[model samples]
Target: MATKRWWVLGCVVLVVAASALAVAQLRKRDFQAICDGAVRGGSLRYAIGDGGIKASDVDELDSELPFGRLSECRASAEDDSTGLTVAVGNLESSSLMSELSGHRDLTGLSGTSAPMGGGWPGVLTVKNKDIAYATVVLKCGRSAPHEGILVNVKQMLVEGEGNFSSDKRKRLKLAQSGAAIASDVSKKWECGSQLGGEVDRAPDDVAVNKPLPLSQATGTCRAMRPLAATAKKWGITRAASTGSDSRAPAQDCVLSNSKGDRVYRLSALYGPLEAGFRKSSSSLFQVSGKAGRKEKNPGWAWAGAKCPDGSDAALFTASSIEHSKENKRLIVGAEFETKMLGAFARDLGGRRGCDDPSLPTG
Candidate 1:
């Protein structure tokens, strides 16, 4: 009898192991399908500079969580006004408790709409009032059949109002419903990565002109160092090349006025209303040439910080005037336009960036 019991136990173990392995394989396949679908179906043009998420890797925000399984994976195809939104979820599991404890920092995320459950076993809160939400829980890390993602998304907007605390809870729950439209659609999970395609025509805004001093220009004719230093600090290893000169390598340059220099440019892009609501964007700026030296229209270049890390490096060039045209133009373009006013509406939004909470003081 004892011998038979041992045999049964061994067989049970083997079956469990096999089942685990099969589950892992299924999850991997599912995730891959999700990735492919995202790429094929999604579209959020506007090539990002170096910094956003990568193509193949999953961003923290996009991964499964709290412990659950994915029931659906699809993409939306819409105009730039309303981008595609993705929805994913997880299978119910007891292990979710452990996973939530492990990542408690992220779980009871403060400043969101709903207050964290008071020592509640499993719950999440959201702050954004404009959207609804959904919830699924999963463990962290990618393990075989056992590993997966649980995603909840904004489904729809809430209509009625309640008491302060009740309203907060309702809004939070609404925000958790992940069934509605998704804005800012893209294929990759990483928010830092850039997706190349087309962007809608951004609206215009009052021009801003931030001019720096002209004395701080550094580097030789071929390469500039001041702006290069800034780029390097920002993890940019490559240098920007411009002009017709092939013999000389690409280099970095800086913009200067008689006053001190400001490295980064801050700007905003208003939303659809075009009244006041606007997002922010960032860029690396460079200006060359002299105030009146009669050189090529004083150098004028603006590089957005939207790429992956340091990939797209474009140089600005203007025709050299015998004296007046390029000189006067450089002053206006570099000093009055690009530096201060900015290139476009979205340019400002790109500079402001997500998660940067500080409001721009007028």
Candidate 2:
């Protein structure tokens, strides 16, 4: 009778192990069932862990949208904590969270970012240790939505103990998994986008553009190091590249005073709203040589570059932060404006593979 009891106990342990594996597989299937396969079941499982979430993590934010063309899926825990979200929409009729707005920023992210390689013209950005986002716009034909379809993926860890909090490896895995989900859905929807290979790494902003002493500037700030002495006349003593070396469209660099306050900003606009930014900004800026004259503007200067997409990308150098120091413009900002504008344009053009851009007529 004792020997019989021991055998029964061993059998119970085996049964529990098999049951656990079955449960995991079931959860994966349910995870991808949200929104007609737009959500990849394995994506979140790969980024985080299989046991970290339940099968109920995937849900439709809105049920009214189409099954496959445009949908939104959220990965969340039962206790109201969301791990990630993916949304799709038409470029013109709807707005993707990662698209460029009228502001100088494209995604409003500053912590870290990198390209989603594998031919997809997309980018991934990490806002902090807890939040990350990915963006991809597919050039679909037939005008179903009458334009391209945009996909935006965002991951926010509100659970207070996400693996990506400080682990650089986990952060990169998050980027890759986010891109993978978007890529899968884009392809399944029949949107013919040139999606490419997997993302290898996503470097932090400081790594991408570490702030250095003004004299020891590098990357975007390196080209303008010669003008560091001139810019110092306006209290600028530090230089840093806010832009990524990656060929991502929008990029910029910042100049700061000893107090770490940004005294000047130089930016390159290459998103769909590039023209809109230039037109709207004309309200505050007189835009030297607007009518093709040799006139000049002291507050700011802008240059135009013809992008490979046949669009005009604008580059600007602005000193709004130090506007009160306008008296120094005549003494130092004039030459500084033109030189910085050129420096920024060259760096941006080279990164994007565009021919040399034209300097502002003013």
The C-alpha RMSD in Å for every predicted model, in order, reads 21.8, 6.2
lDDT for model 2: 0.54
What tens-digit string does per-residue lDDT give for candidate 2 at 193-311?
A: 55657677653343234467777777656666777777677677777664345344345566667766555656554543344344443233433431121244444556666666663
Computed on alpha carbons, the lDDT of every model, listed in order, comes to: 0.26, 0.54
TM-score of 1: 0.21
Q: Which consecutive 10 residues in model 1 have the weakest lDDT in total? A: 272-281
User: Which parts of model 1 have CA positions greater than 4 angstroms off?
Assistant: 30-36, 39-362
User: Looking at model 2, which ten-residue stretch has the lowest summed lDDT?
Assistant: 93-102
> Per-residue CA lDDT of candidate 1, range 201-242, in tens?
211110111222222221111222333343333322221111
